[model samples]
Target chain A: MARNRVGVIGGGQLARMMIPPAVELGIDLRVLEEAEGMSADLAATGVGDYRDLDTVLAFAETVDVVTFDHEHVPPAILRELVGRGIPVHPGPDALLYAQDKLQMRAKLSELGLPVPDWAAVESADELGVFLADHGGRAVVKTARGGYDGKGVRVVTEASGADDWFLALAEDGHGGALLVEELVDFRRELAQLVARRPSGEVAAWPVVETVQRDGVCAEVIAPAPGAAGRVAQASADIARRVAEGLGVTGVLAVELFETTDDRVLINELAMRPHNSGHWSIEGAVTGQFEQHLRAVLDLPLGSTAPREDWSVMVNILGGPAEGTLQDRYPAALAAHPEAKFHGYGKAPRPGRKVGHVTVGGDDLDDVVYRARAAAAFFEG
Target chain B: MARNRVGVIGGGQLARMMIPPAVELGIDLRVLEEAEGMSADLAATGVGDYRDLDTVLAFAETVDVVTFDHEHVPPAILRELVGRGIPVHPGPDALLYAQDKLQMRAKLSELGLPVPDWAAVESADELGVFLADHGGRAVVKTARGGYDGKGVRVVTEASGADDWFLALAEDGHGGALLVEELVDFRRELAQLVARRPSGEVAAWPVVETVQRDGVCAEVIAPAPGAAGRVAQASADIARRVAEGLGVTGVLAVELFETTDDRVLINELAMRPHNSGHWSIEGAVTGQFEQHLRAVLDLPLGSTAPREDWSVMVNILGGPAEGTLQDRYPAALAAHPEAKFHGYGKAPRPGRKVGHVTVGGDDLDDVVYRARAAAAFFEG
Candidate 1:
């Protein structure tokens, strides 16, 4: 049989994790990394900028299907690939919602999904009107190019966004901002789902994501204390989002778990997200593997939990302590059951260089093990 | 911390499987493959004949620790590297036992471990004596360089071995043959263990390996009907062998489960063996990962079974059918829970090109699913 060649347009950690599964399935993966020595360099890779249409098309020429490691590929480039008959999963139409916050908010709202009260704001005056109508406090965001708490800010008054508003007007950018009322909630959670071109969909357990300074720190699978209705609701919402957007890959819907027992859409990531990293060791089928299957239009794998509880703690790089390898001997011996994964990247302060996952029948024990193993890397 | 650079001396599927774990542990792996584009070619590989001292030594100089994907590395070459202060786990002293059948037999017998009755044979007369003591039938094996049923034969009479004895006498090969009484066993089993230089040992459940035409075709973990004393006996035997030989790596001890319930030692392999491939998806720590840990002298991962039953079925290539990749679309669609792995090798009849693993609470279901998925590739 001919091998299915899948071209990935970004060579970050997400693409790195996808290699094992692609190898397992006998698929040839060709990656266009941003540089010569990126995370997914282990695979057959070509170094080129995805924003350069000719560079991306050259990389796409070697593969049967195309997907993304990040959603930064410009819409025009993606549409051009589709127009030229290259099968890009989560096609331009679906990926545009992930690239532009305003588009995503408008689309999800139109789908009757429960999203925070929000609107597109062109200037500080428009933001002021929306903030006053709510509670004089709002969360303001640039419509594009935001991640890991960047390009986002919470402002109590319109004046707080003057700098951003001026910059947008100076660049002749119209309606370049998305604003929403400040969400007061108990905690944050993430629901991950995978959909294929054949309309097959699978959802993993909803996970509670603990955020520190807007960066995901830890994730507890199935969201402790969220059995029955809450878990079901999260899964249903994620499934709807996947189906609504025609997302032919993994879709991660970050949600606000309001104290009043409501779940509202907060953000969307149309690729394997950090919240589902626990699935690599804790679930029957990991998000990376499922994403590949979905994009290839192969049948999706089971999403059942492998244990009663699973926890994943991110190993945020610390101030140039030592290489992660130096910490391996102790961390490995300390928790033999914890599964650690390093992204093969140089460490930098607060960067996610690796993660640890632990699964068992005891929730507290797994959580502690995952956290302790991650802490060892942080040093 | 600095990353540990490991140099693997062979580039078959065993080494291919080690790359994922090495990447996860933040270690760099360098492989000396026998040929260009062999399995494990994706990793940083140098193509050269490992038997050449200069070639092997050149590859050795680039890494911190040296290990093997196959046991064919000459002991003298290993010793030469060790003499130069390069750490070679399963150092030449320990590797010698695996390299020569007679050496392994003598050592295990001296250790008082249960082994088949055997003796060295240099001539037809010696073979006759061995046969006479064992109902005139015995198994004869070449002392070195035998694998996968090669260099082995069944003899009932002196004349049946005349040609071999003549060759040995002409070559002045002293005691070049190992003979053993034909075993009267109901089935074959394998016990896998990993040991580190730090002296930590971990054993996985004994597994029943099914052989077809003298090649391993399937493996069932926690061998059905094997528990309590029988299971403990197998694990203990494997553990004793690893420690006794000072084998600092993953060791596979093949055994004959006698009809009367005793387990006898049959053969040994000092690297990741096919019998333990089920561990990739079935056990908490896969043999490939454990092998790397053991060789690096790092603390090993847990060897606990993740499911009640796990089955692995080898996908042997058939008569010039299609590539394994051709069958993936159907096989994967039919069995979503089965984990498939391909070695990226060009297929030849009866060659083990890939394998499928499935684990669940029910043994019958998991076994059937694994077999069905494997059969798809065979076609």
Candidate 2:
């Protein structure tokens, strides 16, 4: 039997992580990268814009299935690929929900799933009315092209929404805005699920992710005391979302665990998310391999944790005065249990260059060791 | 602090495994390969004969420490490098034991370690007496350049030794023959230990390795039902052997576990061994990284098992009739708990292509799943 070739649209760490499993499975992987020296640098063949139909089509022609590293690909290009008989995992229709928050919110609300009390707003008057009806403060965001902390703003007064409304109007997105009543949630959590084309789905344990400066700094799997009803609820919700939305690959549901013990859908990502990085060493089957299997329409695998507790800490690039190895011996000597993974990239301030994972029965100890090891590299 | 540069003498999978940790530690790695398209094909900077001093010296000049992927480097070349003040881990004096079986047997016997009774013979008359004393059967082996069932033969009849003795006499190897009592052993086990330049040592759990056609098929760490005393004894013996022989870096002591519950020394490898591959995912610190730390005079990490059991199965090349990915979905679908690793090599019958590791609490389940997954790839 011939191996299926997979074409990834971007060449970030997600794409790089995919290479190991792809190579293990003997799959020919070709990445359409936007930059040289990116992760997945060795396997990348086509260097072009993901939004270009011709480049994507040419790249798709050499592979059996088309997947993505990021959700930035234009919907039209994905639609065109699907129209041309190409099997695109998380096809254009599903990706639209991730790309446009308004559409996703509408669909989730219709499905009777819990979401923030949100309203579609076109002007500052509408935003003010929604805020007045709920609370004095509201979280306002552009419906499309927002990531990290960009394109998001908190408004307390009517005049505070003027700049965002004016900007959206200038971009011909007058009606593309979503305002939600900021909830008093306790913490952030993420539930990851992988769904195959055959409708089989698998969900990993819900994890608590600690964010620093809007980037994930650490993740604790099974989220300490989250095994009973919370785990079941999170997994059930993630599986329902995957099946309900027809998501054919890995779906990471960013969730909010409210004080009242409820999980509200915060956002959705259709590829491997940073929150699941711990699974590479902590789970029975890693999310990267599961993603590939799901996208290829293969049977889904178990997402059980290998240990009682697993912690993942991201290594954010720090000051450029020192090299990574400068702290290697120290970290290895200090925390012998830490499993380090360094991406072959030059360090720059605030860049995500690597991560460390530690697993054991003691959750706090593993988390502490993982964070300390990661800090050694980042600092 | 400057990064330590390591020069490896071979470009097989052992050298390939070193790359990931070297990259993580920011160590500059240079490999002297004999062929192109070897496992460490990308990291190797110079390709040359291990017997050539000039080529070895040139490669040494680019790195801070010298190591080997295999015990094939000529003793003369190693001596030459040592004469030039280049630090060679498992230096010439220590490497001789691993390079020659006769010397190894003599040294182990001198150290009061149990070993098969053996002697060097010249003629069929000498072999006849030796075989007659050992139930009319003896194992004859060349003193050097033997591996994987090659260069060794079992002789049952006195006449069968005549041709070998004649060939030895003709080649001035009259005294280079070995005659040994063929013991009935139950199974083979390997004890892996790493020693640093500073004399610090660490040992992994002794593992039972299953062989097929004289090649390793699988490895089960802590050797099921192996008494704690026996496991510790094996590790202690290996550590003592390493320290006594002034061996640095990782050393694998292969032993024969007899039906009488006696452990006899079989062979020794002074580098990362296939039996320790499970450490990459199953141990706190992988053998490759620990080996690097040891040779570089850095502190070694703990060798605790991350899981209760770890079973590793080799993916031998079966036939070149199908692509590896053809078995990917099936293997993964059937055993999602198995973690697959493949060396990017073109498949050929009986070739050491890659391996899969299944690690968890249930030993029986892990071993069964791992073996089945490996069989799929091999088939």
Q: Which stretches of candidate 1 lie over 4 Å from their true place?
A: A1-3, B1-3, B169-175, B318-320
Look at candidate 2 and tell me the lDDT of residue B13.
Answer: 81
Every model's TM-score: 0.97, 0.90
Instruction: Report how far residue B276 has shifted in candidate 1, in Å.
Output: 0.6
Docking class of 1: medium
Lowest summed lDDT across 10 adjacent residues in model 1 chain B is found at B318-327
Which residue pairs overlap in candidate 1's backbone? A1-B323, A1-B326, A322-B1, A323-B1
Deviation in Å, model 1, residue A263 alpha carbon: 1.7
**lDDT per residue as tens, model 1, A176-295:** 689998899999999999999989999998999999888999999989988888888988999999988888899999999998899999999999999999998788899998998888
lDDT of 2 by residue, A103-158 (tens): 99998898888899998988878888998998699888889888766777888986
Index of the highest-TM-score prediction: 1
Model 1 complex DockQ against the native? 0.69
- The true-structure Cα RMSD of candidate 2 reads 3.2
Against the native complex, each candidate's DockQ, computed on alpha carbons, is 0.69, 0.43
Candidate 1 residue-wise lDDT at B109: 96
